[model samples]
Target chain A: MNAGRPTGTRLHWWWVVGAAVVLVAAIIAGVMIGAVRLSPSQVVGSMLDRLPFVDLDTGLTVRQEAIVWQIRMPRVILAVVVGSMLSAAGAAYQGVFRNPLADPYLLGAGAGAGLGATLAIAYGPNTGDWLVDPIPLAAFAGALIGVSFAYLLGYTVRSGRTSVTLILAGVAVAAFLTALQTFIQQRESETLREVYGWILGSLNTAGWAEVRLVAPYVVVGLGVVFAGRRLLDVLSVGDTDASTLGVRPGRIRLVIVIFATLGTAAVVAVTGLIGFVGIIVPHTVRLLTSASYRVIVPLSILLGGAFLVLADIIARTAVAPAEIPIGVVTAIFGAPFFAMILRTSKAVVS
Target chain B: MSTVRFEKVSVDYGAGPVVSDVSLGAIAGEWLAIVGPNGAGKSSLLRTAVAAVEFTGSVMVDGRLTTTLTDKERARLVAYVSQRPRYPQGMAVFDYVLLGRTPYMGTLASESTHDIALVWEALSALRLEAFASRDVATLSGGETQRVSLARVIAQRAAILVLDEATASLDVSAQHEVLEVIDALRSSHNITVVSAIHDLTAAAQFCNSVAIMDRGLLVNHGAPVDVLTESVLQEVFDPSIRVLEVNGDPVIVSLRSEEAYQ
Candidate 1:
């Protein structure tokens, strides 16, 4: 065999560092530029004082501390966690399906969550308890059911299970569930506003509780996805090719879909339906680096978190006292970027 | 040094068996070609050796039953190259070839320097060094075919199972690919079993040829013996003439009666 020069192995430390720096800057900007504007020093000082063994006196008053710590910090952290989860899920979905256009919501997760939240608003007991947040709980259950149904439908349609058939099944299930959600809204028109608000997606109601609720799922799910990154690359080579390489494409795809769905459903349950973060972040990472999932998955988490935090800042401050849905801002920017990607890259879309 | 053996192997995809009781072998460092008309179960028989389809009886690689081996162990012993392999968008040719190291690397571990060196060697041997950075999606038909072979080369397996590996290549590219495989077979003492449609190419390259018809292996011997005019006419149902040019058989198809004036 002819021995050529060793090819360059990817060194993505720069990409990781760049994304982390941007995330830190976005967090600082998110905390400082809210309605009750706090200076950069105040934000840093308050944060440092909260750290263990660092009780440095902050120049801010008690009300300002509450606004910074209680209000903005939790929202910023929730944005980071939820954004990372959604974008990572999107990357995994695209890899598993072997389709560039696939997103976290490709398998009826969005429609299922919508129906769940709608049902909660229409018939669930009216309560103000954070522990018993019926909307999120129902939405989580609904998302799981929706995906399960899609998988079953895909399985039944043919003896051999292919990704194309599964995606088509997901589209069918999403359409059916979406119609049912709309019908429920029509029956109880009073719940229309609440359902529409949740579907539109927002970070306005973010709190420390939401952050704590989603952090564990995001961490565990991301760990599974990160470990399977190389396998994802193997899988992108098609089932027959992957099999010849000693990889079980069916088993790996199932594991990836389960973990990605769990993380996506948990976050979508809480954050409603945030669009474009999953597709946009992963696509941007692919454009900058190679299409190896090893780089795409991790970078998506870091860059996605930063992207959502920045979008949230605009969502709240773009029209002070009245917030635009976080989804709207992402779609506004992401749609155009997605169009540009399609126009510029001649790579295989499938 | 590995030899592939199939004894009474049968495969079925719900609608009865597509390949039945087919037995064959490719000794170490030799090339075996299976030639047949379409729907003659040639591809299915090839797939049976790799465990890609559910099959009965036994397929032995180097005297060990393939069914008894784990997927990784089997992959280490044998590598498969499909006729048309899928390529991911934006995947560099280097990365695509490096995937052949999958059986050797741990689940979570990335490719090491040694693994990457093997990939570079395979690419260079195939004259694919210039296309290393190019996207697999952007490769020409012949180049894509070579890249597929390069991936199998990177696997470093002792035996190769190829299904119509050069069906899409032009005559010149076909000869180049076969020459590369010939060189590798001699250097590495590797065994190759290919299912090809080109009878002339098979007679030129392979030491042995197996003819199949209606899911059964009908004949197996030296290429000159098995690729006779009668066998080709019977199996392929084509009116063809086999001529010996410099001791090599060259197949020529005659026009049908309806087309003749």
Candidate 2:
């Protein structure tokens, strides 16, 4: 047992540690390199002084402090949280299905969230009241709707026997949701730009309220996944094999699907469906490490958070005066890197 | 401690019957070899007992109808080890074998210290300790057979059903696997049921044999009686010569008309 622990296990831990370090650096870079440039030391000092009972002697103007503490910090933290949730959910989906191609978006979370945001923006009172964050609320509802349709259609066809039929059902549901969201956008000339910009994905208006609202759901979903890590390992073998091990593969799969959807929904609600982070980060982590759920689960979480933070930094600093859509930056980097990984790694697709 | 019985069981897979009116029983500590030609429903019979395939008539494990118990309960009593398992690449040998313990684990239950220890012991016993961290896809045919056997053994099941498990191995590897099966049957008192094509090897290991032809069980008896020349000719459709060397029956196929000329 001890002998078995050395070879692949050490490499997984190293990768996780490396990903964590990079995430911290990315967060710092994200805060330091925004439009009104602040040094890393100043950002750090400002943050430390803001914390209760930790008075570091760093004098700063109100504008610098607000930009660093209120704007960039919450936004960066939100990006990390959302990224970690989506990637970890993707890992859970892949592990449950035993298919490397599985992602949270494939299940209708993104589409549902899109519809939710559109309805809130197009129909809600135009006063911009703090109480009505339509996008996140709509996203949460849309995610639930999407997953329900996916599950309903999937179960209707095969009774939850194979992953193939389920994934296909997800594809159909995603297409349907996308079509609905497009129709809604096309009909409303007033809400078209708002819908388009939100769909492009952003962390611009993220605040403590958004962070607090989405964090609990994502954390709970992740907790459920972590607690069921061993079960996911059994699932990686396939349903029949998992059943022989004393797990009801269908029931366990349903649980995972629901939890993963919940996590993805939480993030999509706040950030309006950031794509590629879920698909790329988990696959990259799996390649760097073996397919053990124990290792992959936590590593995907940390690496995913780091990847999003780094991407957010690039989004803010790439064009000096104007910030690019975080989603655009993520896709540009994630697509090429994902292709390279796919070309090189022997990823098993069933 | 209870025996398994298949009474007038017939399995059909959207076609006509694959296994027709098959009645067989495996008592505790008995090694029963189901011998037959290819496509003769040998695999179907084993799968029916494991409740993997639908079948008419009764299939009982531990005196209870297999259909009555949950899938998990049936698995605990009778474990099926498929031939040439299709595995995702990069799966370590230890993890693959550890799946056998799934029947004993709860859905949310963590793999306890005991489960890990059992997996280690199984690996050592199969002499796969050295290859624990190696990818299962990289294993040779013989090594794969041993690893699968180790998994079944880890299942700690009362009844074991193997479907041409050693068919991919070399001659010596075949004997080694049979030897391991013999040890498992004798030591653990597991009711061993295997579908073997090699008549001589089947005769050497099994106390009882059931011959299957075209989805029908043609004959079943002790090895000496069921393995006679007439039965061999009818089932195998070959004029085989049987010789007794050191009181053990060894079957040799006679040359065909073209080869003989």
Candidate 3:
């Protein structure tokens, strides 16, 4: 036992610092090593030139500038934002449910997004421009609708919004939504490949607009979750104990679910249903740090961003010129890691 | 000087009242033990003080009606430790105890230095300082009970409501825990209201005892007055015998005559 402070608290700060350093290194690597390999100086010079008041000339050609700015940068940024959102949302879900197996998609967000994307591809007006894409908006609406329907079902059945009932409701809602999506896909076989590709999850079409679309929701949602960290800790003691400790566990759980769903829905809307990051990042963070939400939430954000960026790098480089879907990459590694966690760690869903 | 009073408190779970018209009070610095057999509503009555379950009548903490107070205000006045409370996996003992300081923290803030110091004090009080960094999920039944007690001690509330807080502990650990609580009541004047199953331990530790049967308060007074042989026979078992041991009541259950035959 360390004097002056709890050992968990001391070690958490070190994890945060280490995660931050790794994230920065991953970002630099993501910028430099892409389809077109650029030197470190070229990547740095291009980024500096794009900064508001900086006019640095490193004699890089226009093609090089477009490759760095227009292609790689937006994809990297989108990966970071999406990964952070999913992992933080997962951490919040686990805390609220008091189950480590709980993930962001436990509330039917993925199925809803799938249905929304299917509908958009099947019947949405053909717009050639990527900026005016209707898939993300439709997917976002569908995700919200799916989660709301599940919440309403759970609320009506239990009258108390207990976590177990809510999860069961979500499972039912997801199955129904997936069946509807399948029917839609069958009716419009022309868009089958498009729907399947989107469902498999890819970051190939990522651009600045997708980044802008998801930023505000992720920022606000993360803020809400961070603010409720202490309450989450109290909630883990069970509802009655939390109530006696001055926390309204029901209200805190609801607020956390809403914000986590919103952030997760926003990212899944653009990135498609990227699996594993949500479950893997938060669980890994808990292993590295204590189970306290105060440490888990921030570290989830940092390490999650780095994990996805690294995954994307491998997705693109492993079979170069023919990029593998990112969801496949995450599952390839996440499945074994998750199984190992279940076998060895006692700090899982209880 | 904080007092907890229940004015005709009744709790219902849709069918009917589990605890009916129960009126009780615990004075400042008093150790009052509520004793009864299973389904006697002892736990329900204790829970009413913390508003854990919805109740019909009023519970006043210190002079204010508990219904009128905010959750935070009510929490600052009373802390409840439930029987068999759930522990989060991988939570450290120190962190679990520090959660008791939730009432004292701001909405977006963490525990203060003073709060951490109180947690340390609580841990040391229960002799749990050595296990401060250990995972709560990894503790034994008795150690977990002590950790639960340490958490409420860190809460620093004027009144503590424990629902069978020591049911899991062995004989010696139970004595050690009750000793710590007795020390707290005398030195800090903290009022403790616990739902206890062990009659002899309750008689030894508590200054006053309340007897309940079938959702009603049958009798309440000093332990010697309430825990009589006749009352034990009626409320618990017909074969129970109450004897005096060092001026405190000790209850023993005699084997039935049919079993001997």
- The lDDT-based order of candidates, best leading, equals 1, 3, 2
Q: A-chain TM-score per prediction?
A: 0.94, 0.91, 0.92
lDDT per residue as tens, model 3, A181-204: 999999999999999989888889
Lowest lDDT block of 10, candidate 1 chain A:
A1-10
* Top DockQ prediction, candidate number: 3
Question: What's the residue-level lDDT of A49 in candidate 2?
Answer: 86
lDDT of model 2, residue A339 = 80
**What are the per-residue Cα lDDT tens digits for candidate 1 across B66-103?**
88888888888889988788877788899999999999
- Model 2 TM-score on chain A: 0.91
Q: Please give fnat for model 2.
A: 0.38
User: What order do you get sorting by TM-score, best first?
Assistant: 1, 3, 2
Residue-pair clashes per candidate: 0, 8, 0
Cα deviation at A331, candidate 3, in Å, is 0.6
Q: Indicate the docking level reached by candidate 2.
A: acceptable
TM-scores for every predicted model? 0.96, 0.87, 0.95
Worst 10 residues of 3 chain B by lDDT: B180-189
